[model samples]
Target: MSMFLITCSSSFAQKNELKELEKLVKRNNTTETAALLSTVEKMLPQATDDQKAAYYFFKTKNLINLANSGVDFNENRSKAIESINHLIKFENETKSKKYTTEVTALKNTLLAELVDEAIDSNRNKDYKKSSRLFEQAYNLNATDTVYLYYAASDAVNAKDFDYAESKFKDLIKLKYNGESQTYVATSQTTGKVESFGFDRKARDLAVKSGTHTKAETIFSKSAKPDIYNNLTHILLNKQNYSEAENYALTAYNLDKDNVNSLLNVLFLYYNTNRLDRFEEHAKKGIERFPQNEILLYNLAIINMQNNQNEQAKEYLSKILLLNKNHFDALKSLGNIELQKDADITNKINALPNTTTSNKKRNDLMQEKRLVYTTTLDYYKKAQAINPKDESLNELITQIQDFLKNN
Candidate 1:
């Protein structure tokens, strides 16, 4: 009975292995190749302790071939790491007696490949793509402090400050006591002083500067929209409003529909109280993004201030149509109605017909009161949602006091 049970177990395991291999081969050119590889990996648990090492070797070779055949490096790298880890585990199980040299060689080869790919990608300015590869290489060999430094530099170049700071702090913790080199001091016999300074002073300076000056310079010289956008942000932060406006203008000139630059110019003109420029930019921005609440609000405010009451009403009405809860638009609309009411009252009082005059005046005033009440309610709701909004709270208080008096 024991012999029969052993035979049945071995047959089942062999069938499973054969099924996995068949699946792998059938999935040769599909995205399921990785899934197939995982299925084969599960079969390793049933492998004899000695056969595990050879199995991992075969798996590594197969993955390498797949990678060479144009599978993605990023995906293949993960598979290769899995195979190497399995081989290492099996070698350790055998007390490093079997496949120790092979496992070490494979690890070294994969590490070198990862480092080379990372360096190549970094040099090509593909920072996001290189970051994962560099991390893998660093993990394989933590002794190489240079990899961490390079990774940190790349992160900084990519504008990922948090990642860069983490990597640099890790290097500092490594306590790398600077690189050593032979130096020949100046002497009467020696022609000149020769020293190798590997303090990474240049790299440190580049990182320490932390200014996107180079990016700005490139923007100024090449007129690239992305660089111009970045420069605009930097100049805006520095309060160089004129330069920021110029950069934003350049970006807008390159791409007329660039909402970012358009909005920047709009805010710039608004802050400087350049009403004419604000109106011009606000109109353009509104045309580009008609449904934008900010654009509509800005345009409405400008129109109201300029006494373009009808146009202001149009914009406010559009905003209210889009968002019935738009408190600003509601308030502006109420103000416009109040102004209309005053105008109607004055005209009605001047008319000769006393009966029609009184009727029109009462109707207009009632309409004005209703609008005022609606505006007050909206302002109160907005203030409740954002207690820090003093303007809304003040308006609500003023309207409530006015309603109490009248």
Candidate 2:
């Protein structure tokens, strides 16, 4: 009976000590709370689970205050998360209803700090660190889907492809939905890139109101199209062409006007030797961006591959009109002329020996000479555009020899 009384007395004393700690928490006594946490932790084995939960609860609160005071924030943040999680689990299982309101408020405060830190880190391009903070915040507060999305996006920015892919797939599984995004656009009238007129005022109002009210934004969650495109880019980088093409097509189907998706599909089709599909996209790209020099140049190559010399010449001429010093287009034009000149040489060779001096033979030779001259002229212009190509120098050497003999 004496031993039983002693055990009861010890338990009662421990509860009183926890009550004192609770008073310190209520009074916001950071220094005293911090000093007592270590002593409470040492009693964990002897303490009841309720006492243990209270101990962790105070420890978490104390450390969070310390974090706000500019102490080792990362260390304190990590410990606070660990202790709070345990505290909540114990409180819930025991149905103690202990510190529930304060706990909820405390958790939200931690989450806000974590989100702020994540944004700062991402702004500084420390994507790896940003991803970690956001993922931590997401785990702490499961309801805020935004944190999870930021974690995945920053993972992609960091090039942690495996993690990003997993999170993106999870996003799909969740059927995550998002609102429309306003974006800065070039004014067709002014020909100047700028945000819409109301964006600044709207953004300021949102900031003042602490809400995501209507304002210009990018990378908003309606993410299926972007997610597929990003997956396609990852697969393409890994040379997984089959999967890349599938994902690229999915992205295109999601948003037809997405130029980036179109470009990815075009590249995938061309690389995978789907010439018909490649031709289709190339033509579409030209229709969409008629003034885009690279697209125009690519269309020329498509025509050249199909042996439509006249069409190829027309495309190349359009490029020259846009930028006369387009070296590759000029070189390709020279190549087509050389190919025609080769046919003339073959016709001359097919003639009988006696026909060499005839008017017909002379006329054919004259046309062949003019073709050679044109090839040399175009090639020389291309060489002038970029003087470093040794292949061009070699071609010039051959052209000079042909001109001297002819």
Best by TM-score: 2
Question: Best candidate, lDDT-wise?
Answer: 2
Residue-by-residue lDDT tens digits, candidate 2, 1-406: 9999987887787787788888887787888887777767776777877687788888887777777777897787777887777777778987876667778888888888899989999999999899889988977876666677788889999999888777766766776654445444444456555553336665555445644433445544467788788778878888899878777998888887777788788878877889888878878887887777776777688678778889999999999999999999999999989888777778878888884457778988899888889999999999999889999889989989978997
Give candidates' CA RMSD values in order.
19.4, 8.3
Off by over 4 Å in 2: 1-10, 16-52, 62-76, 82-96, 180-221, 280-406
CA-lDDT, candidates in order: 0.65, 0.80
Least accurate 10 contiguous residues by lDDT in model 2: 210-219
Where is model 1 more than 4 Å wrong at Cα? Answer: 3-43, 172-406
Backbone clash pairs for candidate 2 read: none
Q: What is candidate 1's lDDT per residue for 1-406, written digit by digit as tens?
A: 9998986786577566545644654455334445545664676666566545655665675676577678786677677777777677667777654667866787899888888888889889999667767877776666666666667667767877567646655664674333444322332244444332344444334335642112111111222454455555555656778767876787778666667767667766766678788878776777789898877887788678879989998988898889887767776676665555466557656766677567776676677567568766656655655678777667777768877876
